[model samples]
Target: MLVDSHCHLDFPDFENERDEVVARAGEAGVGLLVTIATRVRKFPVVCAIAERYDNVWCTVGTHPHNAAEESDVTAEELVNLSEHPKVVGIGEAGLDYFYDRAPRDLQARSFRTHIEAARRTGLPLVIHARDADDDVAAILREEAGRGAFPFILHCFSSGPALARTGVELGGYISFSGILTFKKSDALREIAKGIPHDRLLVETDAPYLAPVPFRGKRNEPAYVAHTAAVLAETIGLSPEETAAITSENFFRLFKKVQRPSMRSA
Candidate 1:
């Protein structure tokens, strides 16, 4: 079974049909989903969605776009909020120079705070890096120097340097629908070089829907399409791709109880 390791079920895009969206994922063989949080203030909403669906889980942190708004959020707060059984990861937070929605310094500060929470809580940090790979890598390296913490480079679309740095620092690289785009040859080459155990697939849904469904609103169900492309990219069958990514998911998000074999 596939695991959509990143998505936003709490977004208004799925407000009216969240149930149907999740049902479609299960029907499509996506046995698990993690509805990532983009704001700590709205965390209860995100957590509620996870609580409503047995197969769904969540993370807690402010997105880089909202870093200024949640600038005062402390690592202690993130650790406390993450005590919920449904919260399995931390931060969709990192540098987003592409958007520049918040001050870069604020984004960096928030990213480090989330890292601290990850270190304290042992929940994997769900990092969202875009157009700021160098700074992101610097922060990651500096933070790793402080102490090792598990993390996933969520929705990764960065250059090879950051990809190599992430894996070297013991972080998993999660590819999204972008991996299936026709022009992502360089990204595919990067994927091919990644070690099998450190690879993962996600949809980052309500955003980049994989080929054929491109431009359409994405959902957990479409993760299978991305998985199919990843299988081809790495010379594995669709079933093998699903198995390996799912295995990687559980290994990193250790708090999540693996579904029974029968469930798959």
Candidate 2:
């Protein structure tokens, strides 16, 4: 049983035939799926999916690309929205210097605000860092200074230094389909060193789908491919990779209430 720790089933890419998309996820052995958030103002859409699926959960956050538009967001609003049972975490939020669609300052502040909200709420912070490794690590270290909160660096494609920093900070590391790419030898090596207890897997679907499906629009069902490559990368059986990562997901996202969470 695999758990895709991060995905976006709420996106329109799966809109017309979401039932099939979800059914495919189950058929692929994806036992649990977490629908991530990109816009807090539009959270009702994300929440509706989590509320509908017994095996799905969600988060409350604004992606860095929308930082300027949602600059007025407060931790209180995130906290209030996160009180729902299905809302298990906070933010797919973090620095994204690669795009810079949002001002760096706004992104940093929004990232910290999500961190603070996670600290207050006792929920894991689902982070998204892209070409902003130093800034992201710095902010996480600084926030940890104030008070340590649970966090997972999702869809990680950065260097080993960032991975080490996250592990040293007692945070979790999640790899996406990017790891299955032909040029991801270095990433595969880095993933090999991640402590199994702190390692996670995600699809980040409708985005970086793994090889064999890389060019197509990704869905939760493809997470199994990522898991297979990760297993081969780490020299474990695919079944073991599923069990280990699923356990890591539950350990990191403790607030999530899934039947597997209890078993793991």
Candidate 3:
């Protein structure tokens, strides 16, 4: 079984057939799907999807793009909302200089809020970093000093140095379908060196739908393809790859309740 460590099922892209998307993932050997919160104000949409599916879970945090809108959100709100059993992690938060969609200052402030929430709740922080490597790395290094906490650079596309710093700080690195791209040899090189205990996999769907389905809409089911690529990069079998990454996932996102075997 595999877990889609990040997704945005709440987005309208799935509204017409959310049920089928969830079913297709189950049929694809996916046992758990974590629909992440891009906007805290839209959490009801995320929670509703999670509540509807036995194997799906959710998180609460503002994404870098919406960080400006949620600039006033507090760590208390994040921590309190995350008290729900279905809520397992504290973000989709981090820097994204690629678009500068949100004011950099707002993004930094919101990212810190999520970090504080993770520290307060003892849950893993789900980070999304892109093109803001140095700032993201420096900020993580700085905030990490405030307290001991766990976090993951989800759908990681950063370089090996950031990966090294991430794993060095007791964080996990999750690879997405991007690793399967023929042009992403650099990403594969980093994937090849990730320590077993710190590696995880995701789809980040309905976005970056991996190769073989690059032009298509993605869902949790596609995590299998990403895992297969990782297995090859690390010279392991697919099943072994799944087991290893799943174990690392459980270790990092400690708040996720392991569903019973029946649900799995």
Candidate 4:
């Protein structure tokens, strides 16, 4: 079985066909899904989806692009919300200089707050970094000095320096469909070197659809394509790749109970 480690099932993209989308994922061998939170204020909507699906779980933190609006969100607030049974992670939060949707400093502040909650709650931090690798690395390192926390660089598309730093810090690196892009040879090269135990795969659904499905709306079902490509990149069979990444997913998101998979 496979897991789509990150997605946005609550987004309007899946509004009219949410059930169909999830059913397709199950048909495609995706047994679990974690729909990420982009805004703390809308967390009820995110949590509702998780509540409705046994195999679906959720996080409770704002994305970097929406940081400005949630600048005052406290670590305690995140920790409090994380107490919910369905909330399994702390964030999809981090720096996003590429968009500059929120002021850089504000984004950093929000990122650190989520880090603090992750440290306090012992939940994995789902980071969303772009065009701010240096700062992301520096902040993670600095925070580790105080106390280490589990985290994953979600949908990673940064430089080798950042990838190396994240792995060295004992964090997982999750790749999205972007890895299957024709021009992502360099990204593939980086993927080849990551330790199997520290590697993961995701669809980042409703965005970054894989090669064969490029230009189409993405869903958890498509994570299989990303996994197949990553398997070839790392010299593992598709099934082995799926198992390894699913293992990594459960390892990092410890709050999630690993589901039983029957033998064929």
Candidate 2 has what TM-score? 0.97
Candidate 3 pairs with clashing backbones: none
For each candidate, the alpha-carbon lDDT, in order, equals: 0.96, 0.91, 0.90, 0.95
Candidate 1, superposed: residue stretches over 4 Å from native: 261-264
lDDT tens readout by residue for model 3, 167-187: 888899999889999999999
Q: Model 1: per-residue lDDT, tens digit, 1-264?
A: 999999999989999999999999999999999999999999999999999989999999999999999999999999999999999999999999998999999999999999999999999999999999999999999999999999999888999999999999999999999999999999999999999999999999999999979999999999999999999999999999999999999999998988884267
TM match of model 4 to true structure? 0.98
Give me the overall lDDT of model 3.
0.90
Residues 127-237 of candidate 4 have per-residue lDDT tens digits of 999999999999999999999999999999999999999999989999999999999999999999999999998889899999899999999999999999999999999
Better structure of 1 and 3 per TM-score: 1
Span of 10 residues, lowest total lDDT, candidate 1:
255-264
Report the number of backbone clashes for model 3.
Answer: 0
lDDT of 2 by residue, 192-244 (tens): 99998888999998899899998999989999999999999889999998999
Root-mean-square deviation of Cα positions for candidate 3 versus the true structure, in angstroms: 1.3
Instruction: State the TM-score for model 3.
Output: 0.97
Better of 2 and 4 by lDDT: 4
Order by lDDT, highest first? 1, 4, 2, 3
